[model samples]
Target: MKRIVAAAAAALVLAAVAACFVYWDTVRSWLPQEVAAVLGAETEDGGGERDRSAVAVRLAPVELATALDRFETSAEVTAAEAVEITSEVAGRVETVLVEDGQRLEKGAPVIRFDDASEQAAVNAARAALAEAEAALGRSQFLFEKGVATEARLETDRAARSTARAELEAAQARLEDRRVRAPFAGEVGFVAVDEGAYLSPGQEIVRLKTTDDLRLRFDLPLEVAEQAAGIGALRLVSGPEGCRQARLLTVSPLGDPTSRTRRFEAALPDGCDLTPGAFITVAAVTGRCPEAVFVPHKAVERRGFESFVFRAEETDAGLKARRTLVKTGVLTGRRIEIREGLDEGDRVVAEGLQKIEDGAAIRPAGEEARR
Candidate 1:
């Protein structure tokens, strides 16, 4: 009786296992790759069995060549000398000497404030100085003629010195009411009109050098250290082919908030870039002579790991072998494959995400890779 019951239980267990096998494809298709693979699925992309049909993809061969290794970043076009004009003393505006967009040289007057009282004080001080000088001359002559005492001459001399000092003080006050350009530059909009009162340090107008232009940018600490070896920056966007800008300076101090260092480069002469306009810049960090590189699209990033699908020919056709790579410097359109690939190796540059490990592929490399 016991043997007969055990045989019936074995038959029921075999039937249940057969039923699960029939639905294995559909059930595991909805599960994660790890769970699905353990449960009879056979793929690496976290899915069910991968399709055997080939996916059309463009292939880029790895090359051992010399290429620029650059770090690309956006930079702002700026005038080498730029400042906003401001008043140094409080007064009512008398005249606006410069109009909007007018270019002025250093020491050129931009605006003048009301200086009637200052002018009067200057005139009075000048008259007192002249009077004191005349008295000293008279006293010197009289002393030579024995008609004036030494004490009298000395008193005249002291009075002349005092008067001279007073004149200088008055003139300096008068000049403070006039605003002059500190450097040669074109004026922006005139901020004040006639009869408008302005306080000390109030803005009058903006001045920016027209021809003297620079490119200003920021880079992180690591990239900045690499940029130290480069002599120039490439202007990525321009009518002419990538123009070179002369490297000027990098700030000694770094910004604590952004953790970046400021960099400035002198733009090439006759380059008609507007001030305050932004332009893209790329700086070469280093160059590789015999390094392996592939198209930028050939690499795929999964989480923190970067991968490339290398195309290998097999008896059936071409198959994709997903490879883990270590990357180096990146230029414009290509990235350095420091590891995981060799020269002349083929990689699926386009349609990287549609396939996984051991997936079939069709190479469609019609256009030449530059």
Candidate 2:
């Protein structure tokens, strides 16, 4: 019975040894080719040294490129000139000359008021002036013939002058009855109908000169100084794309409440943009001629510190050295490396998670593990 128990224990020990061998062989087969080669070399040399397989990574060389230092903000569209058309004198509207949404040129008639009384006054004044002129001519003839006094001739001349002034006043009144456009623009809703009596200073319609639209935006006080010398600005809308605009004016003062400065820009002509639409404004503050940039994926951030793995060639082979970097503006997929990097330095762009400081690296497109 003791021999049977011993035999069972021996069988159990043999089965455990075979299971351990199978598990180790499966793990070795699953290892990366480069790691397996290193381990095989160490095992064949009868060494118990730790594996020194390099981490495979892709590299990108730093290059100088143009970096646009710009500030983006929201802007509102406005007309270059907008005003509410009002009546200068009280009169009854005779004709509604312009319809809503009608485009008109400068001096085009927009509204016509009843001018019968004004025209009658003008005609009466003209008739009185004609009679005064005839009388003045007769007085001058009598004076030349020595039959009229100088005082008499002066009285006739004064009467003629008064009549002429009356006629001029009447004509001005007649002209005021007809409302004309102040400038070239598209008219908004007409507020009065024909035969409607309007009082002086009453709003008649709205006029907006929108051939060239203006964009107004506010920038924070800190960034206001950067936009001082910018010659042009860019406006971006969803799907409409980007349009160039000229900087028209900037407010000399900042708003105390919002701590922002107001800026205005003129949009290009022939664009189908309407006033009151919101758009994105981008103002280029400055440019860096020799800015060093790299793929954004190359940067690794741990807390507030940014790091990049640099591929350095040495006597042993290519190795990845972790480098600390200061980053600037990020434009699209590229990032500006302001410090701790130089032009032409190689950095690991991909496979960064598998690497550590001072680890061996086999760069992309290079053969390893013969």
Cα lDDT of all candidates, in order? 0.84, 0.86
Off by over 4 Å in 2: 1-68, 142-147, 238-242, 287-370
**TM-score of each predicted structure versus truth:** 0.68, 0.60
Per-candidate count of clashing residue pairs (backbone under 3 Å):
0, 0
Best by lDDT: 2
Model 2: number of clashes? 0
Superposition TM-score, candidate 2 onto the true structure? 0.60
Cα lDDT tens digits for candidate 1, 1-370:
9999999999999999999877776787687543443333224434333222566577888977786667888899889888887888888999989998898989999888899999999999999999999999999999999999999999999999999999999999999988899999889778999999998889999999988889899999878887866798888884374388988899988899998999999987788777878989886787778988898888988899999999998987889999999887776698888899997789998878788899887654333212
